[model samples]
Target: MTPPISRSHPGLRAVFELAEFLDHGQKLPEQSRSLLAQALQECIADGFDTSLFTALGITQWGGVPAVKKIGLLRRDRVLRRLRSRIPEWASLSPNAAAKEMSASFRRYETTRWPRERHSAKGPAAQPNSIWWGLLRSELGVPGEKRLAQILKAEIQDGFEFPKGPATVAGTGEHPENTGTNIR
Candidate 1:
């Protein structure tokens, strides 16, 4: 068998190391999840199987991958896009939501690497706190609000979404469900 084609540059040490992290099933500092997510996303785009980390990234990066950035830099515009997509987000079926959520990054990724495409869909956004926190960051929401609380609010406001399977509850058995807490 032949090796996979990738747009990753040799100088991108952080990205490669991150790839190793996923390959080895190692975790990093809690605060660095997004950066890890960004790296895993890059690898997935490059034809690597990387379902180890949460597959979310800042849409503000346009299409280029950032090696070390933490939070969303352009809060106003990113938050605007997130708000504008609420109805679109809420209306998706479970499978479609996964595809769409993963494509949130893919939508930009394709612009940079035109030929890059993958069948890897991410977990849904509504039940994921990373998505909720980033989405509601501009709403003056209390920082203490967890994903359950945010999801409850979303449901109360008619934005009900599907939950992750209960079968994967904290067992760490499936790679796709690695970053999720289904219980």
Candidate 2:
């Protein structure tokens, strides 16, 4: 006879699903959509997913209840990583901040698309590409949000920029280079 799926398996499945969702640049369920959103807020506030996942892998992977417990750990860690990446001046809730960051990143991704690919005669003419173009335009990078990601990543890591922003008309050296605070 075939074996039944263990109760413990669902938790592991959820953890894996959540992790993959993050990897693919999707947002977690909304606070209203999830009872756990409040707790997630605290995890984000604390900034500890990497450590929690480490602990789970090493010591807590036995069953569903344990996995569920670890989900909270992972969620918090995800929130924390996101919060750390955002600048302090934004002063938004962690969830909102994460959503903005995701939107901003999506915009960055869109701008990287080849113009030929997005042209009506190009790959973007496909149904999927068509939807993507629409979504990208909606998430549309405001000058400020784009600048914030560049500055935040630079200031937080003390890392050199991989590439400078695309220059805008008459903007001169990209707005990123003007006497703005990196913070």
For each candidate, what is the lDDT?
0.34, 0.36
Worst 10 residues of 2 by lDDT: 174-183
lDDT digits (tens) for residues 1-183 of candidate 1:
223213232223234344335444555444355566666777779676543222332221334333212122222222233433568755655345445555653343345223322212224443232232333332222122231133223222111112221122234232134423221
- Candidate 2 per-residue lDDT over residues 1-183, each given as its tens digit: 233333234333444445434444445445322423443554576785534333223224444334444433332332333345346525765445645655654554566444433443213222223223323333222244443444344222111122333221122232223311111
Off by over 4 Å in 2: 1-79, 88-90, 113-183
Residue 139 of model 2, lDDT score? 27
Which candidate's lDDT is highest? 2
RMSD for all candidates, in order, please: 18.4, 18.4
Question: Where is the poorest 10-residue window by lDDT in model 1?
Answer: 157-166
Q: List TM-score per model, in order.
A: 0.19, 0.22
Highest TM-score: give the candidate number: 2
Model 1 misplacement above 4 A: 1-84, 112-183
Q: How accurate is candidate 1 locally (lDDT)?
A: 0.34
